[model samples]
Target: MSRLYGDPIEVWTREGEPIQFVWRDRLYAVRRIIDHWVVAREWWKVDDDDPGERRFWRVEASPGQRLGTYELRFDTTGAGWLLVRAWEC
Candidate 1:
């Protein structure tokens, strides 16, 4: 099972990809990026003042011996990084 967080976080990236992130005061190093995708506003809602496109990265990360699967989001309209979801390993 996974948990939804939606908490703002600080992320460090390499070549535009997340390599490390800090969440809840602990730092996690991304071991691998499992998936990556982008979501855009619907064509019909283009003028609805949406937050623009959102990019998501599902990654395998670890802080010490505790490894977890995390979903991170980047809002193109400048909402910044968010730790959206997580699954414990």
Candidate 2:
């Protein structure tokens, strides 16, 4: 897996499920969502109580000709969307 820290992206969702995303100047259509979960705020690591949760989605996608699995995250604290990791399948 390759890590991408804070890589900005645009996602298209249908009924709260991510259908596709644009990242690194390419469009990737999600074929399947492998997992979905929420990361709760780490209260002990922060000074304040406003550490918002993060949503994560692991998906299998096709970017043009190649297929890959990627981990996407959304920060509720205004950090925006991020492409966390990706690997060829």
Candidate 3:
């Protein structure tokens, strides 16, 4: 398999939502949704009483209008997003 770019996204229950988006400096008509995933996690120990809060959903995000399929992350944390997984079909 070939290597990809960008970061990991925090998926949720939103349809056709933008995990990442872009508008090229050139032409248009290059929109595509090729990313998908389900994320169910809780921020307990890190958030306090507001802990045990579980989240779930499916997301198909991407990066830029040119390199469309390039994945990226909107990581809630400040360390920046890391590519955890992806789909190629």
lDDT of each: 0.93, 0.86, 0.37
**Which lDDT tens digits does candidate 3 get at residues 1-89?**
33444443333323534443332332212244454454433544455433332222223433423342334444433433444334433
TM-score comparison, 1 vs 2, better candidate = 1
lDDT of 2 by residue, 16-87 (tens): 778999998899999999999999778775546467878999999998778898998988787578888888
Which predicted model would earn the best TM-score? Answer: 1
Position 11, candidate 1: lDDT: 97
Residue 54 Cα positional deviation in candidate 2, in Å, after optimal superposition: 0.5
Candidates by lDDT, descending order: 1, 2, 3
RMSD of 2: 2.5
Model 3 spans with C-alpha error above 4 angstroms? 4-16, 19-30, 41-46, 49-68, 79-89
Question: Could you tell me the TM-score of candidate 2?
Answer: 0.82
What are the models' TM-scores?
Answer: 0.88, 0.82, 0.31
